[model samples]
Target: MAKLTVERLKKQFGTSIAVDELTLEVAQGEMVALLGPSGCGKTTTLRMIAGFVAPTSGRMLLGGNDITRVPPHVRETGLVFQSYALFPHMTVAENVGFGLEMRGVSRAQRGPLIAEALGLVRLSHLADRFPKQMSGGQQQRVALARALAISPKLFLLDEPLSNLDAKLRAEVRTEIRSLQQRLGLTTLIVTHDREEALTMADRLVVMEGGRVRQVGSARELYEEPRDAFVAEFVGRCNLLPATREDDERVRTRGGLLLSSRRRADESSSASTLAIRPERIAIEPGHHAEIKGQLEAVTYLGAHTEYQVLLGESERVVVTRPTPVRDDPMLSVRTNDPVSLTWDTEAPRLIPETAKD
Candidate 1:
């Protein structure tokens, strides 16, 4: 395993800037996930590290050796693409051993390495089966085994689970996490799925518009987003427009008072309130209450989602988990008078300058 580092890596295509002065590090045996929407430069950054795309400027180093200009084959990194590029004509064993073959490993010595790689992905029994004979999950595991057989210093995956179904995605998610931990591989994954990145990565690197937005553990980003983009992107959040009163007070522009969850910086001009849907209570409580009409209700089995039209101008959404005893919100319907409230410290004060 090796520590990977990139310093001010940049990539530009004509008038379009794909990545802008990106800098980050992955310690030995650490897994970091890069998350963002399409065209956010996540994939371009990964390709730069893999040596498939040369950086327009800046440097990349693996274990202190500069490999910014190194060719892909000489970089010694294993890559698993979104599409598992296994040869349909080759058997599983042949597919996994292709990397070794290209590196000129003796034919006699490749058997044990192939078997070990297959065993790691729990596909040793299907080694002789062709790609046409295996399931999608099995095929993906074979691709992973192929990458592992080369004993790469850094393991890079680009949306490794996007092709799998929901159930298969969950199963493979657990499998990939466990496999990475067992091998202690220094890995970097590029994904647009927040939940996937949160569950798999030790730390998250969120990006947008060719720049880094925030870097933190999953819980930190979820609980205390530094900006409005992060607040709404990491999870389901409502950014209510608010007017500031002195330094400690704020209310919705529509005149609903809300307590700030976090203390704002003395220099900050907080003009918005950020709150998660699940944090709001369905009924009146000791906290600040606001009246609205329940415009829509969606029964999502474990939780019910309500779109409340506050007065005639604002809308606040609430997601409440189904209770074992009873939830009065269940009988509530559209246009009904709904009283919603939240604890004194549930909403966050977002400064106007921090929103992106």
Candidate 2:
């Protein structure tokens, strides 16, 4: 609906800084997710965008218009909260039409608009039901419908699907993504859940300690994290302590040499290495780089997980897609000798601290 530009956005609650020098841009009709752990300033950042919280310093531009000082009601941005925030006494249609009503639209004008919004969320059949009469998923959809009724330029959701059960959460997120795309709506989602952000957003902005950590596509953030915090936060990673060896290599503590990406901005040439568990392959040949004993095996429906004990103190976890044909891992036992290795380019070496 609109391009959102947040420049040098900073917020301080007295002496405690909530968001520091944060800057990000969301393209028109693109969905971006603010992903992080609890208390990472994601919610605060969303509030500032919604104009509910004042920024100590910064500017917010919506569709080339400055909305930094605009009142929330007049910002022309639709916001949906985690709690749904629907009135219990009102029926579904009434709740969806409430925004239009507040804008002084007549009852005749609100009917089709409310119906269209409800249809977008597939809740037209439940228009007469109250919040207490519907499931968590249904209630949340109603909240989404209500937000869309105003035809706002920017759509914002703060943990919008967190209240639903796991199955419902997965189902609803897909529905929301499809709906947003169909309407070409510019949307921003705030989520702590990794898979939710990975699946729903076109791009991700990982934040921590009142600052942006890394921003990229889901694959970039997962496979090419800029720092250790991002590597561990975005996905399953096996972090190994290593000594840097020249420009593109690191020697592990156990004397295993591995290739890694080295950055020039890094003060130290060498740093800790991050390797995804799924990238590690189990080799049948005895000449594999690292030898270990398979400590445990877990059989997930789609993937088989292996826990291999490397040396005495370090254990590496590997997850591989289940083969179409049944294999040895199905009958694999603990304490079996095995060798693990990975491609040269899969491992990423990142600094202990982020580059300014």
Output the lDDT of residue 215, model 2: 97
Off by over 4 Å in 1: 261-270, 284-288, 323-326, 351-356
Question: What shift in Å separates residue 29 of candidate 1 from its native position after superposition?
Answer: 1.1
**lDDT of each residue in 294-349, candidate 1, tens digit only:** 78888889898888887567888899886546655556668778788777577777
lDDT of 1: 0.86
Model 2 poorest ten-residue lDDT run: 261-270
Error at 41, model 1, angstroms: 0.7
TM-score, one value per model: 0.93, 0.93
Model 2, CA-based lDDT: 0.88
Local distance difference test scores for all models: 0.86, 0.88
Q: What TM value does model 1 have? A: 0.93
How many clashes (backbone atoms < 3 Å, residues ≥3 apart in a chain or on different chains) does model 1 have? 1
